[model samples]
Target: MRDDGRAILTPPARGIAHILPRDHPQRLVLNDEVHARPSEILEAPLKLSYLAVFAEGEQRADVWRRVQELAGRYGVDPAPDTANHYSANFGPFRIKCERHTEFLRLVFIVEDGRQPESFEEPALQAVPPEWLAALPGQLITAANVLLQHSDGDWPEPERIATQFFDGNALVGASIADGAAFAFTDFRIRADGFSRLLVMDHGMTPRQAGRTVQRLLEIDTYRILALLALPMAHVLAPFLAARERELAEVTRLLVEAKAPDEALLFDRLTRLEAEMESEQSRNHYRFSASVAYEALVDSRITELREERLAGLQTFREFLERRFLPAMETCRSSAASQESLSQRLTRVTQLLSTRVDITREAQTQDVLASMDRRAKLQLRLQETVEGLSIAAITYYIVGLVGYLAKGGSRAGLPIEVDLVMAASIPFVLVLTALALRHHRRKAARES
Candidate 1:
C-alpha cells in the first residue's frame, strides 16, 4: 500500500509483498504510482477556469458590477462575502474571490476526474470545444468592461514581454499590457492543469476576489510574477528619476566654484548630503527588489549576475554621459570665476582712481593755504615800512617849525642857514626816536 492509503502493485512473479520488519520496514514497497493516474480513477471533470484580479483604485464599484455581470453571463453562482464560503460553481469549475490590502484576488479550480462535454449545461458535462475558442474573446470583453467602467481612465498599456518555463521546457511567452495579460503553459500534461491564463484589472475588492479565484486554479508563481511586474514598472520611473537627480546634483557639486572658500565648501557639502540621500534610496530600493526576487525564486545566481551587469551598465553611463556633462559644467563655472575676478580687478582700479582724485584735491587745498599765508606775511611787512615812513614825515615837519622859532629868538645867525642845517639834524634825530619808541611800545603791548 502507498502512504496515501491506496493499494500498491507488486511484481506478479513475487506475489503479494509483506509488511516490513519492525526495524527497517523494507518489506513494504511504497508505491510511487498510487496517485500517478489520479484523473483516470477520480472521476472528476477537467475544465477551464477564469479569474480576475483587482486593486484599490477609483474603479472598485464598477469592477464588482462587471464581475457580477460576467458571473451571470456564464451562469455561475456568485460567491457570498463570507470568510469560509468564498467559492462559486460554474460548470465543472469553482471560482473563488478574496480580499487583500489594496487588492483583490480571484482563483479558479477544476476537478481532474472527468472531462465535461458542455459548459452550457447547468450541471457537470464535458466542456464544449467552443468554450476554449470563446475564452480569448471573453477575456477581452472583461478587460473592455473594466476599461469602460473606469471611464477609460485606465493606466496606459505597458507591454512587458517575458518567457516562462515549465520545469526545463521553454513553454511560451507572456505579454502583459494595460489591465489585461495572458499566460499559456504548454507543459501541462493533463487537461485540468493545461495552459490558460487570463486576468482582469480592477479595484481592490474585485482584484482580491479574482486573485482568490486564480489561486485556486493556477500555479502560485504566475500570480507572483503578475503582481510583481506591475509594481516593478511603477517603481522603475521613480528609480530612474532619482538616478537623474543624483547625477545632476553630482554635476553641480563638481562644477560649483566658491569666490570664498567657505561658500564653496558649504555648497559642495549640501550637494553631497543630498546625493547621499538619493543614492541611499536608489540602492535600498534596488537591493530590496533583488532580495525579494531572491526570495521568490531560489535561483539567485542568475539574478546576481544580472544585477552585476546592470551595475556595470550604470557605471558606464555615468562615465560616458555624466562625466561629459560635469566637464561642461566645470567649464562654465570656470568662466564665471574668470569673469568675477575681472570684475574685482576693475573695481579695485576704480577705487584707486577715486583715491587719486581725492589726494589731488587735498594737495590743491594745501597749496592755496600756503599762498594765502605768504601773502599775509608780505602785507604785514609792507604795513610796518609804511608806518615808519609816516612817523619820519611828521617829525621832519616839527623840526622845521622849531628851526624857524630859533631864528626869531636869537639875533646872531641867518635863519635860512640855521633852518636848513637844523632841519637835516632834526629829521635824523626824530627818525631814530620814533623807531625806538615804536619798538618799545610793541614790546610792552
Candidate 2:
C-alpha cells in the first residue's frame, strides 16, 4: 500500500506459460493422454458386459457412427471422431468404449442392489438386441463379470468355481494383497462368454474398478496374443518347405554349371518372393502378438497376485499355457529373419558367380579377336610385297623396250645388255619410290 492510503497492486509474477508460445498441435492431446481410459469407480454387486471387436479400417467409421447413434438414443452428446475413448451413463446402464489400433472394446455396466440370481443374465440384456446383433466387426472377445462384495460365511473357491464357471477347474487368486478374490474357469461357455467372479473383500471402489479392469485386459490381451499362434502354425509348414527348397538351391549353387545357373537363379528368386509375401502378410500379426504378450505380463504383474490355496496363480497358468504359444510365434519370426539372411547371402554369391563367368567369356572373345587381327596383318603384308614386285617387273620391261629401240636405231650398245644393266637400277628406283610414298601416307595419317 502506498503512503497515500490507496490500495497498491503488485504486477503478477512471470510464468513460463506466459513466456511460451501458444500450444503446439498435439500439446493438449499429449497432456490428456495419461487420463485417457481411466478405470471407472465401480461399486459392489454390479454386472459388467464386455466385448472386443476386430474390424477392418474402413469399417471403423461405421462403428464410430454407430456409437454416435447409441449416444443419441440415450440423449447424450456423441463422442467426437477424434476421441479414442468415451464413457456415459444411460438410464438403465453405463457404457464405456475405447478404440484401439486394431480393435474396439465396448463395456456395459449395470448397477444392482444384489447379485443376479443366475450369471446367465448379464448387463448386456439391457442393451438393445438389434444394436448387439448389428455391431460392426467380428466379435473377438466377450466376457461377463459379476462383481459382488463378500458377506459373512464366504463361499468356498470350489463352490464359487462350479457355480459360476460351469464346473471347470478354477484358477483363483487373492489379488491386491488379499483385498479381493478373483475366480475364473478360463473357459468359454456355451453362451460365448467367459465368466469372472470378483469377490471384493475389502477394496475401495477405485481399487475394485482397477482390479476388474485389469482382469478384463488380461483376458483380452491373452486372446489377442494367442491370435499369432494359428498364423505361426500355418507358416510353419510353409517355412519348412522353403527351407528344403533353399537347401536344394544352395547345393545346386555349389556345383551348377553355366547352363544350370540361370535356372537355379530363377528358382531362388521365386522362393525369395514367396517368403517375402508370407512375411508381409504375417509380420503385423506376429509383432502385435509380441506387444500384446508384453501387455499381459504387465497387467499380471500389476495384479500383484498371491496364489490361492490349491490353485494356480495367473502367471503360473500363463507360463504353462500362454508362454508356449508366444514362444512359437517368436521362433517363427526368428526363423523368417534367419532364412531371409541366408537367402540374401546365397543370392549375392550366385550373382558373383554369374559376373565371373561373363568376365571370362569376354576375355576369351578379346583374345580371339587379337589372334585374328595378327593373321590379317600378315596377309596384308604378303599382298603388299607381291604388288611391289609386280610394279618393279613392269617398270623393268618398259626400260628394256626403250633400250631395244635405241639399239635398233644404231645409237650405242646391245639391247639385251643395256636392258640387263637398267634392270638393277629400275628395281632400285621403284623400291625407293614405294618407300617414300609409304612414309608420306603414314605421316598424313
Candidate 3:
C-alpha cells in the first residue's frame, strides 16, 4: 500500500534472477519524484490560509528549520533534508509546506470555519502567532480560501461578491467541469489578504483537494510572474539611454580616424560591459517570470474553467489585466537582448576597422624600410669598389718600388709590366675575399 492509499500489485517473481543488471543510482528517487507533493484530501466547510514567500539560498535552510521546530512541537517527525514537501496535522490545523526553487509556500488548513462570511475568520488564526512571526522570508503572496458545500446551484454573483469580497467585481468560473464553483475578486482587502471561495458540488475529497491546489497555484504563479513587471519599467529608461548612446557611437564609427577609431572602440567596449552587467542582473528574473507565467497558464487550463453568469472568468481576467504586464516584460527582455546584440556587432565592426588601419600603417612602415635597405645596398656596393681600387693602388706601388730596386741591382725585371700585372690579381683577390665574408655573415644572420 502506498501513502496515497493505492494498492501495490505484486509481480509473479518477487525477486528477479541475480543475473539482472544493477539499477541506476537515482532510479528509486526519480521514480518517487512524481509523487513528491501529492495533494491533501480536503473536505467542505474548510478554511485555508496560503502563503508564498520569497526565500532562496541560505534562507531556505532557515525556513526548513522553522518547519522542523514546529513539527517537533507536535510530536511529528519532520521530513528529511532532501525532501521538499511536508504535511502534518498539528491537532488544531494541518500545515503543508513546500520549498520551491526561489520561494517557500505554506498553507494552513482548518476544518472548523464557522464564519457566515469567508474572511471573518481565516485558518491562520489557528496557528501560533509567535511561531508565525518567526517564520522567515518576505511574504510575496497571501490569500484566504473558503471551501463550502453547495447543492446543485450557488448564490447569485452579486450576493456572493458583496458578502465576501466587499462589493468588488468578481472573477469566477464553474471549475473542474462543473464539479465546483470558484469565485474571487483578486483584491487584496484591508486585512492584506486576497480571497477565494470554492463551493463544492459533487466532488470527492481528492477532487476538492485538486481544485484548491489549482486555485492556490494560479494565484501564486501569477503574482510571481508579475514580479518582473517593475524591473521592466525600471529597465525602460535605462535601455533608452543605452540605445541613444549606441547610436551615437555607431555614427562616430563611420568616419573615425585611426586614433578616433581606437577611442570609439574603447567606448564601445565599455558599453558592452555595461550591457553584459545589466543582462547578468536581470536575466534570471525575466526568464523566471516567463516560466512562472507558463505555469500559471497550465494551472488555469487544468481547472477546465467555464464562465459563471455576470462575471469574468479567470482566464479572461488575466488576459485583460495580467498578460499585458507580461507582454511588457517580454518586450523589455527582447529589447535588451536586441540592443546587446547590436552593441556587440558594432563593437566588432569597429574593432575590425581599427585593426585594419593599424595593419595598413604597419605595411606602409615596412615598405619604407624596404626602400631604405635598397639605398643602403647601393651605397655599400659603391664603397666596396672604392676599397678594392685603394688596396690595388697601394700594393702595386710597393711592388713597383721593389722592382725598381731589383733593376738597379742589374736583375732583368720590367717594373711597369710587373706592377700592371699585379693590379688585376690584387683587385680579384680583394673582391673574392669581400664576397666570401659577406656570404658567411649572411648565412649566420
Taken over the whole model, the C-alpha lDDT of each candidate is: 0.40, 0.88, 0.90
How would you encode candidate 3's per-residue C-alpha lDDT over 326-387 as one tens digit per residue? 99999999999999999989988987897899899999999999999999999999998898
Q: Total clashing residue pairs per candidate? A: 36, 0, 0
Candidate 2 Cα outliers beyond 4 Å, as residue runs = 1-16, 21-24, 152-155, 390-445
- Per-residue lDDT over 83-186 for candidate 1, one digit per residue giving the tens place of the 0 to 100 score: 32244656655554444333343444556554333332222133344533333211110110011122233222222112122332221111122333333322
Candidate 1 ranges with C-alpha deviation above 4 Å: 1-43, 52-54, 58-61, 67-85, 90-93, 108-113, 116-445
Those runs of model 3 whose alpha carbons end farther than 4 Å from true positions after fitting are 1-12, 113-116, 404-417, 440-445
Pairs that clash in candidate 2: none
Candidate 3's TM-score reads: 0.93
**TM-score preference between candidates 1 and 3, better one:** 3
* Winning candidate number (lDDT): 3
Best by TM-score: 3
Candidate 2 lDDT score relative to the true structure = 0.88
